[model samples]
Target: MQQSPVDGLDLVFYNVPHAEAPAELTFAIPSMKAYCGSEIVAHTLHNLYTLRGAKVRDTLKWVGYLDQALDHTQDTEIFFAQHHWPVWGNKNIQKFITVQRDSYKFIHDQTVRMINAGMNGAEIAEAIKFPETLDQELSIHGYYGTLKHNARAVYQYYMGWFDANPANLDSLPPTQVAKEYVELAGGENAMIKLAQKAYTQANYRWAAELLKHVLNYNPNNKQAKDLQIKTFSQLGYMAEASTWRNFYLTGAMELETGAPRKGVSTEMLLEMLEHTPIERFLESMAASLNADRAKDVDMVINLVFSDLNESYQISVKNSVMHFKAVPKAENVHTTLTLTKPFFLKMVTGQSGALDLMFSKETKIDGSRLDLRRFFSLIDKAPGTFPIVTRK
Candidate 1:
């Protein structure tokens, strides 16, 4: 029985094909491909909001599922994965499963071994190598997930961003450091010349790095910006991984023009958020609170959703927001009662402070000024920001 919700609801279903029955056909969802790298690796290596980094242990378990299927389906004449073409013949199927299983295990075990030897993520990434048995096989080649980045991901999974170097414990921000670097390199012109030299040598990575420092120091430097765009294009063309290529090319595009104004539609966003639990939205609001603005304020507001019959207590103290789902607090400075639809409308900006203050359906039981103060502490984000250029 699957423990979690298959499609947002708990389900119980019998597994077809008893263990003892001969299996001429078998199907398996490749969880290893989802977590590890498949035909294309997802751009989740350093994204903190998602899974953060690949969970090596979970990856192994996914491959183990495939291995288990292989054991049960020894007589299976055909095997197929959800995303790939089917494999025929039992021996061919066995080889395919074994190769994939070993590939994931190899990455996990080898990365951990390097971690124990006092090598940091970058160093481990540079030194790790695949054996000929795995290297020669096209099935495990890094068309999607390169060995270099995946090894670094494994390091990130265990050690995090810190490399134990005291000098890097609290380094300056990138822009500040970039300014210092440009000044040390004898100004922007000299940096551009150096970057030009690297670019001429087809050392696009080094050229991009140098140009990045130049651009960071003075985003208006036309010479540096043009060269950087060229460097990004070259790097993008050279990248084997589609994700890396897309990122590099997109960086160039953003630098040439600007970030695209269009994004996910508001209606689509609202629909997605509607299905999400209310606590998650509250958490997002807490994260969006401006700590500096809220430091001097302390407030507790009770939120009552009539449609859901739910009450939550939200408190801000010492520049931190805390939430709890319970009955309304008697000591709360204010209580606002409304339906879930109205609350969501407020969240998505379909409604605003004026709407909240004047809406006929919304009931305000305490000081409206305190409610306004609470809303003021939360900062509004534009949803997109400059990536390759400074604000």
Candidate 2:
């Protein structure tokens, strides 16, 4: 019999700890302490782009964990975290964790309170304020995540992008709106003069907005672009949060010069895709499908992964693609049998339909034309589209 990876190793797995009782461990060290923080009680909430925005419920859960730690580690002399410095002395540790926990709760409860009062994300962001108890604490200050943005994030987590305004529900795109705004402001020159006045008054935010409208209406307007770049630089310098600073600076860079040619390497991308399930790839492909092109066509393709011994039936109808992992469909317009690696290559553009048809590693059965048609309907995104300016 073969021994598994942990066959001879001692290990302990436990369920999540509750506020009433926490999972405890002992270590031979001078200071008897606990490491209570993880993603929750960092110096600030470093909210990155996950599938969904960061949730206040998660923050509240961390507060519960902190409560458990406080209850269980009464004699603990030190406390540490995943990021930043550690706290020493039981009294100081207690104060630190208590403030950190309350700060999140404050943001969450207050945002909800304002939301219930009929205020939208932007309104709540500007209106919400922290009590002096949490506000005066340096540990919970917005170094990575601002209270303003987090307030809005909490709003988005609850209410989504819509702010309950009927006019905003179906507004024109930014370019068209900019054209209207610029014309209303008299002309491009008038817009620039207003932006210059705002910049002179050190109101970079308003200046940036006006310049954005001018540039959106005419991207090649050199004067507007230059002023916008300067405005972005000022905003970047003024930002307290590192994320906001980086975003503003990056926007300035992209506007002044073109977007950088560099991006994630193909090898790195393929490695990431390798770990992702085939269902997600199919979903992404469906999302990228050109609906206009596929509206008049209907096709079905059977994909067989010979190495993985998995097969899926994919059907396109009414400009939408539906996929299922089942026995190969008898009515499939095309059947392609290939290894997972070859399939990855095809999806990533390293291999085309001709390669699939001709390669010794793949076997194709049924209509080649249908297979080609399927690939053609999937739009290929340009890797480096402009961000701060018109493409």
Candidate 3:
């Protein structure tokens, strides 16, 4: 929880009573909200690594570990995080983390238990809440992340993928649904006016939900777009979790335009990726390529990243893909040699296509023209559009 300089976050918005009214705006929350990026991202990577096995190399000694547990006997315990006030004593830190761990673990465990008892995911989220004492506790709070969403994540872990609903099987996409909702709830202008009222009354959460529909219905509606941005601004200003603030701001940016990829620092993700299946990563890579370039140019490119100890010969036939992770030195389009992290960096677009050309990091020798052509076929991973439905 030690805060870094990158941890500082803030969001600001105007305080108009309604879209029709003009009024002064100010900082929604009057405090500095900060957190450690390395810490949060490391934890996230670990969770994913543990939940779904990842692939890492023995030669590469480090993954994403940011901190080491200080010897309790030598280093005195007086603080927790850099931004927040601290408490002394190892007993205190132990007590603090005990409740923190139990809170998330409780929601996770109990929600799964309830799912086994036939309560759906949403039901468990509604019925479950952290103990009142824990609710009052600052560190274990919904300000950064919520118990509600996490509970649903737990239910999804144990239960079947769907909520057992036939209606959801063929439901319209969010944008389509939002358009219908806006028409039913009056109109674009009406929703904007109402959202402004909710925002002004310090009812940010509701404002967010309503304005989201408005923006989705009319993405170019500046009034609705501005209102949605302001809503996320307020939420970001109020958030204690740096991750939450980043997500909100990212969402706001996407609302103004279509989704854009903000590639993460690949160093850490690459380290954790070793535990991932070679075929899955290649599949994801194939999915990442720009398919339009290869619409009429279907071909196969076998890629072998030696340092990752992985091999995948990717074939694109009739727009259907087949990735096999077997050793083959056949007449292929490309034979690349690089470490896991750098190759992944290239795959995620964090590094440029020619950086490898100018640098000593990686090499691409065979059929360079067709290799580029084959790499052009895949698509990137979709946005915060739920990997699995929780909304």
The numbered model that scores best in lDDT is 2
User: Which tens-of-lDDT digit does each residue in 1-391 have in candidate 1?
Assistant: 2333445544222232311122222332222111112221112111111222333334444445546655644665655443446666768767776776676667768989988999888888789888999778776676566777777766776788899999889998889989999999999999999999999999998999999998888888999989999999999899876667888999999888877775544655877878878899899989999999999998999999988899999999999999999998888899999988888888877899999999997999898999999999998777577788765
From the highest lDDT down, the ranking of the candidates is 2, 1, 3
Cα lDDT tens digits, model 2, 1-391, are 1212334543222233322123422221223344445444556644422223333334455556656555544666765655787777878877876887677677778888999999998888899888887788888777787788878767886888898899999999989999999999999999999999999999998999999889889989999988988999999898887878888988989888878786544655998878878889889889999999999988899999898888999889999988999987788899988888988888777888779889998988999889889889999775677778764
Clashes of each: 0, 0, 16
Cα error of candidate 1 at position 266, Å = 4.6
Query: Per-residue alpha-carbon lDDT of model 3 for 320-372, expressed as tens digits?
Result: 66778778567666666677767667755677657755558877767767765
TM, every model:
0.83, 0.85, 0.57
The residue pairs that clash in candidate 1, if any, are none
Residue 294, model 2: Cα distance from true site in angstroms: 0.9
Of 2 and 3, which scores higher on lDDT?
A: 2
Instruction: Tell me the spans in candidate 2 whose CA falls farther than 4 Å from its real position.
Output: 1-36, 48-82, 88-91
